[model samples]
Target: MKKSLLLLIAFSLMVMGTQVQAAGQDIRLVVDISGSMNRTDPNNLRIPTANMLADLLPDGSEAGVWTFAREVNMLVKHGLVNDAWRDQVQEEAEKINSVGLYTHIDHAIETVTWDADWDVDKDRHLILLSDGLVDLSQADTQEERSRENQASRDHLLRERLPQLVDAGYTLHTLALSDEADQDLMATLAQRSGGLHAIAYEADDLMPLLLQILNRVVDSEQVPLEGNEFSIDPLINEFTALVFHQPDAEMVLHSPSGESYTRESDQSNLNWHGNARYTLVTVKEPEAGDWQIETPAHPDNRITVVSDLKLHTSSFPATVYRGFPDKEQTLKAWFTEEGQRIDRREFLRLLDAQMQHHQDDLLLTEKNMPFAEDNLDFRASLTDFDELGEQQVTVLVDGHTFQRQVTHSFNVQDVVAANLQLPENGGTPKIVLRAQHPQLDPDQVDFQVTANGEAQPIDYRGDGEWQVDLANLEPGREYLLEVEAEGKLKGERLNLVLPSMRLEEGSVRALDRQPEEPQETEESQQTPPDFVPNIAPQVIPSPVLPTPSASQTEEASEEEQQPAQSEEESDPPVDDETADEEGLFEMDFSPIKSWDDPRMLWVYVALGLANILLFTLAFILYRRFIRRRKERHDAQVHDDEDTPEIDDLEFDLDDELDPGK
Candidate 1:
């Protein structure tokens, strides 16, 4: 009876779990076909890239492709990935041509997302590729056209982007040329937690798109080193991408030294060769090392479709030098499909290490310690002491198989927010001094909380914000978050301040009770007037160590200042708007249907042809009517000149005389 009851409970739990939808990736691809693409991508490399993407998509994932310019078109209708869907995509890719007049980016996005459904269990991703700024054809002045374009961009960012974020969409954007709007593309990626890349030339599009795809989708890949990659027994299938020159020969060598080429007739191997790249998919690939005999290319890759794979956590794009809390902690483990592999015997032979590098210099290499449960390995990333772009690769080397993943991040200066606990009993203030001169003081926002409840903040001039902590029960902690916009060089930047923690009575200098009158006034602060300000000061940071009361007092005195009145603290709304005007760069040179000299001449020629056609038609109609009237008059005159019945009597008499 006990065994039967256990089985019954397990079945009930499984049934309950089935009520939730399974997690799957739904990807939408949006491409631009504007007229500018004629110069940007004259060879139409996007077609081959799209085909490769369709073939490489996983079996259970759903995807669709769209092409847009003045109008949005569904090139490949959204559907589940299957052989039929892929064939249809291949057929439809040929229809993409560079004949569109305008680039209506907002309309394309709206059309793609208007009727789409969202599910909590699925991750929806939109990959947008473009090569030019937002241009809409209109008959207006250059400045007016620019304003309209800005308005369209603003609407897309302010309204549609938030909806996508709320619906859990990762929007990866690609800017294809120097003329493309890099800021907007970067902002979309940052806001949506997606990857963004810029392609300086058309040739770079394929490699960059592949990079974005690999990041967005957690597909397992075997590391290709020196044009060779090893495949283990657990891998059911694998796809290899090889790039080559036009005149060079490409070949694939199998584990048993069997050579395969484009002409090889094998039921298990599907070879797709192109002018620039060859994509090969193998079913039930043989175990052992395989080699692609082609010229060395950086973009050569191999991804696998398998049940057993290595799963790892994603790393941040940026980390601070002195902030330990913001440090990336890598947690990785092996899995059979989606279930965790927890067998000790299986995990014992596996080794995982993270190799860090800056440019060509090797910084450090460390191993991830296994957990007690033998399920996952973790290690704190502590090698970010230097500034600049850094690359880290996680390599998992097992007895028979190997897997690796690499990503890059930037190390920046420590941006701190310090909470000044008053030496004498009063309201605690948070001070953040401006570290960069271009930091905008007016464009700031704060998300502050006290003991899990929303706490109001009063913005005082000079980078100080006052918060009330009088009602704290002496042991609870609070959280504060600050976000601001600033400028770097000549370009605008979105600055995300680190979240700071404040514990009650932890850093107080003395055991003093709060003053009653000041406490009452601080508690009564309103929410609307709690604006934020930016300045150069240190706030609480993970690198901060607990200091004595005197140390805290000294830091507070150096940073703190007298609070300003509400009128003086609030920024002028007009000046803020003026400063932000012309954020979107619009090119008026492309708007030239009526402005182009050649088009003007074409219009004049068409107008003259219409006038000549009308005159010829009128002349022909008048001649036809005149001819008909002349024929009628000739028949009437003949009837009038001839004799009638009165002359019949004379005719009869003449006939009788002729008979006699």
Candidate 2:
């Protein structure tokens, strides 16, 4: 307590009127989290020298974190050492998403080099705890674990390992397994200015931890000549460093009543906010690896979260729902599991699935029973989730099929069609066209029928096919079949319909909802005899007057914004005019879009969703592949030397600050 009091007094004195000196070491730890490390190291070590080595670091020493598997992951920032808050750090570390793919130590080294925004002359060390078994099997040119083809892993490590040392990162390898290369560990140590050690078992880890601690604490002369600062407790959020720079002042523009100003000092060049972060920031520096981190949004590692709220934007795609209202909700649904939506979040997903299908000349006139209020002509559509084992499928217009399939969500198909129907249409002169770059146009075949009888079609297309019809019925149904043998197939029935719109206030808004079920007739409503709504001009909200810190209490969401939208909730509008219904009074709030890292959750949630999806897909794919290999007489190389895949970084845009 006395030591702490003295330290505080000294710190205060420095802040008040001393030489205002700045000097401290900003150390970062780059850990290796691979499958091999989990295996019992030599001497029955649980996690080799990791935990033991951790115990030796100077308490409250400046540090950042990075984890490596197939890729590299930064866990914390280069700041002060924290022993008391380690439990949370350890928990987060344990949860690091990793898959045993193939670890590229060289790649990890390259990654740190790319993110090197701090002083290379300072005490920068890479405390690499690994089995020392190099993975030279797969290539990481494209993300994910590729097939293991490189057999010269040992030789590569021998010839290529020294480059990382030249990059000024001290490599302290904790050899955990007998299969690990001690020579390489020593070489890494010598090259990177790191010490090589042997941590065989769980108990053996302590010495290594202490060794690192001694190196950091004893060297003692590492001086960080910069300013010191601290953001308010709640508003400030950031435990680790994603990126940063020196001489940066992160102004925390108080939200309503919580204003904070932090001036840089000699010892503290960056601000560290953890626990329950409630702060926002105004960052001045634009370059470096140790950027400002908000406590409220550590995973996001940015100020935008504090600005935006539960926000995310997705590519445009026509979402199908069992209910009409749900289809036009603009709500993002999980493609694999539509029902799994986080109600607390505000999603901004795109509706981008139309362009792909619209361009291929696949969309033909499909007649809806009620075309009076609809203006949509679709060519082809297929549901992959329910399409059984075959990954690919085609959209058809009866006999003429234009094959279109997207196994990944990244690709959206748009099919377009332009054909004229003659009044005497037996098979009115039909012309089929295919215009997709990814598609084989020759595989497309055409079958047309105007009134019950089907007729063969001729190719009049550079990309189009033609068919001659004898007689046609005006309001009678006509079928257009597009069949592509081994390529694609689907039917496009003609439907002349008017454009449709959604009703105003048709459904209650909730934070989250399940996928819509089948809509009943009674659920359908007559379009309200409302006047056509004039599109309101959106004026950005103005910068709000900041609340002084002295203001103890503040307003709620309702008090701040007009609650008239809910107060005047009228009867649900019909689906036909839902799009045109007036909801909120269309005046824009004019406020400066200053950032709040806390709001980064919106974007973080969005990015996490994307990553989780990819990870899930990869896992399922691996499982199916393994099952197939089990049955086939194939060489399944399940080598023990496979490394791990590092999770992608989290970014924020919408979820953080809406203004941002």
Candidate 3:
């Protein structure tokens, strides 16, 4: 009874754990058919893109499609996916066109999510594609129309976005052209922890959609190198999406040297040839090497359905330059079903690498090594100097199979300032420039502090500030902190600048070194490395302080000290080290705890649930087992109460002696 009860309780806990992680992923497509799309998407590439995404969506996952113009219409009803659902979506995709007079994005989103059951066991996602700003046809006058559109946008941002965030709905947005509302799309994605991409041309839609799918689904991949990949025994089915020239044909070669094409009479193959791309799926594929003969394209990929999969940490969509608490770290591991794979023999055979890309250029590559326990792989991304869209593709290579996943993020500077500290004991001046074009420089104000006391700043023309050090003592080290406040795109930006060390009439930024050997005259001509500034504007804050006398003494005592390079000399301390050294702090807050009434109620409800479950389990065991025991005891007692045959012997003697 105890063992059974233990098993039942274990099963209940497992179910709760699975719910916490969520289950399969669900995606909803919301497309714009605004009249402007007639010029942006002249080829009607969205039809095929939608069809392809439907094909790629695995079975048992939930998906739906909706298109909006003046009216919101459902192309595919949201439900669990199957062969029928995919076919319906393909049939319905043909109806998508840029004939509508207006774009009713607000109405479309509301209708799609009006009856959404958020309690479903799935990770919800919404892919919103647009080629124009929000427009509605309900107003008679042009001014009324503009007013209504702005109101609708405000409602979507202020009300709808917060609800979606609370309900765990990630919104991946795509801007189909320059005329599209890119800022709104970016805001929605960023606020919801989703992805946003710009399709410079209509033809770019398919590849961007594929990249988004790479993040949406949990599918393992077989890495393709030079158009070749290997399949393993564990693979049940594999699909390859290959991009080729408009007139070029793609050929697939199996390990046995057998070549197949779209014309091949293979019962286990499904081939789809579309404009600029071809998708092929092979079932029960042979477990060996396979190659595709086609023009090389970076977006070409192969995804497989298997029990063994590669899972990775969700990289941030945006990386802030000066936030130490928001540092980016990437991790990957193998999993079978829902559990992590820890067997060393299997892990030792695999190698992992991350490829960093900026547009058509490959910025760098990083090798991900297994942890000391040899259970997973991890890599810290420190080389983010490139300030633009960065796509990181992680590839795990093995003898028979491989896995790959791509993530993209943008690097943005919060503030751009250069501290011109004199080496010859002169005046300390700051040349502060706005990195973001939207920042209003004239309105920016600074709060300067020297040794925890406020200092007066003399603002000079053209983004220059002169710090008066006449009253300050010479040769005494001073810790200087600068805070900038400004109007950025009509919003207040608070920026925290890196601290500076001023001593002996010289000043240097503590987060950086006093001298840079690799900094060339030409490189210095460009903007300085951005420092965090806040107060209704952007800039990264510093966590490191100037080296103390004790640290300098320890550095001198070390006999075999390595040479300090420009980057290594005095880098800003990470959050972990900052906590250990107790130098600075990063602010974080929890929404729920003992202090919140809602949290207290939630905890009380959970405690009551646990008690109820325990009581129910105890009653079930006792009721059944105790009843069975009682029945057995009653039978034994009845047998004892009845006279035995040995006792009847005396009666037999009495009967023989004639009724004594």
Candidate number of the best TM-score: 3
Clashing pairs in 1: 417-539, 417-540, 418-539, 418-540, 433-535, 433-536, 433-537, 434-535, 434-536
Error of 1 at 29 (Å): 0.9
* Candidate 1: tens digits of C-alpha lDDT, residues 1-660: 999999999999887664432466788999998766776688887887788788778776789999998789999999788889989988999888777756778899888876445555677888999875565635233345455666676677668887888888888887776446544565566567676666767888887777677666676678888799999998899989887885467899999999998889999998875687888999999999999998878778787877777888888654655442545788888878788898977787788888788645889899987786747877777757676446677778887888776665546543334454432223345555432323345654555554456666666443335555444443345665555444444445454555555554343112222122111111111111122232111121111111111111112322222232322322345766744652652223232234344455578899999999999999998886576455444545775766555544544544454432
Which segments of candidate 2 are over 4 A away from where they belong?
A: 1-23, 41-56, 83-87, 96-99, 113-121, 139-168, 219-660
Q: Count of backbone clashes for each model?
A: 9, 154, 22
- The residue-by-residue lDDT of candidate 3 on 400-476, one tens digit each, is 77788788676655554455432112234444444343345677788888798887777643333555544554445
**TM-score of the candidate numbered 3?**
0.60
Give lDDT for model 2.
0.35
Write candidate 2's Cα lDDT for 1-660 as tens digits. 999999999999977542222234445556666554444332333222233223334454555566776667766544455665444454455444323344556666656555355444454566666553444333222111112312233333444444544444555565653334443454455445455555544444543444444344432111111321222322222222221222333443323433243444423224443222212234432122232332222112222111111111221112211111212111112211224334322222212122222212333232212112221112223332120011111111211111111211111111222232211111223344342322345654444443346766666423445554333332333444333322433322222211111112111112222122221111111111121121111111011011001000122222221112221223346887766664543334332222423235558999999999999999998996565444332223434343222211111322352432
Best model number under lDDT: 3
Q: How close is candidate 1 to the true structure, as a TM-score?
A: 0.59
lDDT against the true structure, each candidate: 0.65, 0.35, 0.68
